[model samples]
Target: MNVSQIKIENHNPYAVSFKTNLREYFMNAASVEGIPTVEYVSLEELKFLNSQSKDIRTGNITINPEDKEEVFKALNIVDRGEYFDNETIKDAIINPTAEGMRKLVGITDKFTFERVYAQFIGLKNNGEYDISNRVANVLERRFDEIQHRIFNTKITINEHGFKPKEDIEEIKQKNESLETTVQELQAQLAELKAMMVTASTPKKRKSKAELVVETENTTELDEVKE
Candidate 1:
């Protein structure tokens, strides 16, 4: 994939065009790689539009629409921009990157990681730091024990980097397990509610000792009168 090219039309100040060597980011698996896994909108684009236009829109993130409002509130403080909930603008600001190029394709060099890391740290210091630290944190895990449970000898951290397949499988398994557990809990809850409703209905009580004594006394009195 080639680096993305952005074109801003002089005619329409509000609308910006984005072109990438890779396919467009979509909601499904087909465009999963294209999708921005980080912020809602690109910080680099926000800064650019802020310079060019008056009333630059802020909080215009739509990449993660579900939590867009919350994200907007968090990011709106930067560059004194206006918050726009409009879908058109939101869609335009795809994959906001700290480095100004949110979607970088055809990566050739190892320096890309450092550049991304530096930009990420800068943005984080600016209070808009949210990236895939799970990948990074997972990379930090190591085996430092003298004797290992699985292996008799000392275990060391594997120098080999993480593979995409392992991460994908782990995510898939977790999701499936969570879904199954949710279904089971829902079924159990429904059954408990049904049992409660059945138990709550009024039931007839047996005659009390006081009522039986009163009836015997009345019968004795009637016999004596007879």
Candidate 2:
């Protein structure tokens, strides 16, 4: 929760890469011998990493609890050094007039809100979600809204996990219904084909007019007289 620095070491033997369109970092080259090596990354970078992966959370990469100036120096976190006067910040928090304290609070709130907002954006676009309603007091209401949206039964695993037995059963039922419909259609087609074949076959029925014509005509009369 430090406002200044985030120091971490990649314990993996090979380099750990965190790449995105906005930021890419290759951190923690393998340490030599029994000695330890650590790298200082910014809080912003840590946020990005945490949102995308569980490295920081799951103990793959550990962050130092201590705050240091190396965070600002190693990373381009603060573009304007003049605007980020450490002494002034300390004074506002330590020995503040009412206006100074209010200004500091406003700045801190704005920063926190924006960071949480970025997490939401990451969730929407890339399915990288991390919302802590308990830790972030200012963003609790918004986090609750997001949590509801994520935990709704209608949602998929794109943002969160939803693997209820009901969903599986519903899909199975739909498949069975579709199979039944297909079978019915095939039966109807077979019946129609059978009717067509029956209609096309020649019938052996004789008409009464044919018998009267037979009576009028002699059967092989010329040949029989000879």
Candidate 3:
């Protein structure tokens, strides 16, 4: 492998989405973070930090254990393993597209414990929390399932392979037959309706010519009697 061709191995694509979910989860924490101590996306604080760091995009920070604990305590957040289990894994498999599963896996694969801890510290003063290690381990396994499901193309739907031509022809024939039957039935119904209309109307009375013929025969019979 050429040294010049080497790629930075730690580049992660879904970082923005991961960070957004983390913010939401932190807001929901039952501890200190349960209520917004301040507004989300503290622009002033981030700007100050950005000014201090050489790499503003991923600024460095130092966090002590006590600080970690306080941050975790405030967020009421616990270790990754504390929250994840076999049942959770099963559910994650069933709902692979879930945001929580995606975020958990993204955080684990994208960021280091120290770096993540620093991020938490940047937002708060207290520390006693470390989610990176636990999240990384649990998510590593969970993400494997997601990867398998995504890449493994063998599926129930696939088993029924796409027979588009045959299936379409079958449907087309059924539709044509049904249409013909409907047309024939409609014609028969129209004929029956015409017959019913004709039967319902009264017949006209005898014509005047027929009445005159009958009157002449009656007069002849009267004259013969006289």
lDDT of 3 by residue, 80-167 (tens): 5323322233333333333444433443322232233333333233334333333334444544544554422122222122224467
- The digit string of per-residue lDDT tens for model 2 on 1-226 reads 4533456765443456775335676775445331335766667777666567645543345455344334434333343312322234433333324444333323322333233344334333443333233223323444444555432222111212222346657988999999999999999999999999999999987678887677556555655777
Descending-TM-score candidate ranking: 2, 3, 1
Q: Least accurate stretch of 10 residues (summed lDDT) in model 2?
A: 152-161
lDDT of 1 by residue, 44-94 (tens): 454444454332333222324444344335435443223333332222123
lDDT of each: 0.37, 0.47, 0.39
The lDDT ranking, best first, is 2, 3, 1
**Model 2 spans > 4 angstroms off:** 1-4, 20-22, 67-226
Global fold similarity of model 1 (TM-score): 0.24
Question: Can you give the lDDT of residue 83 in candidate 2?
Answer: 32
Better of 2 and 3 by TM-score: 2
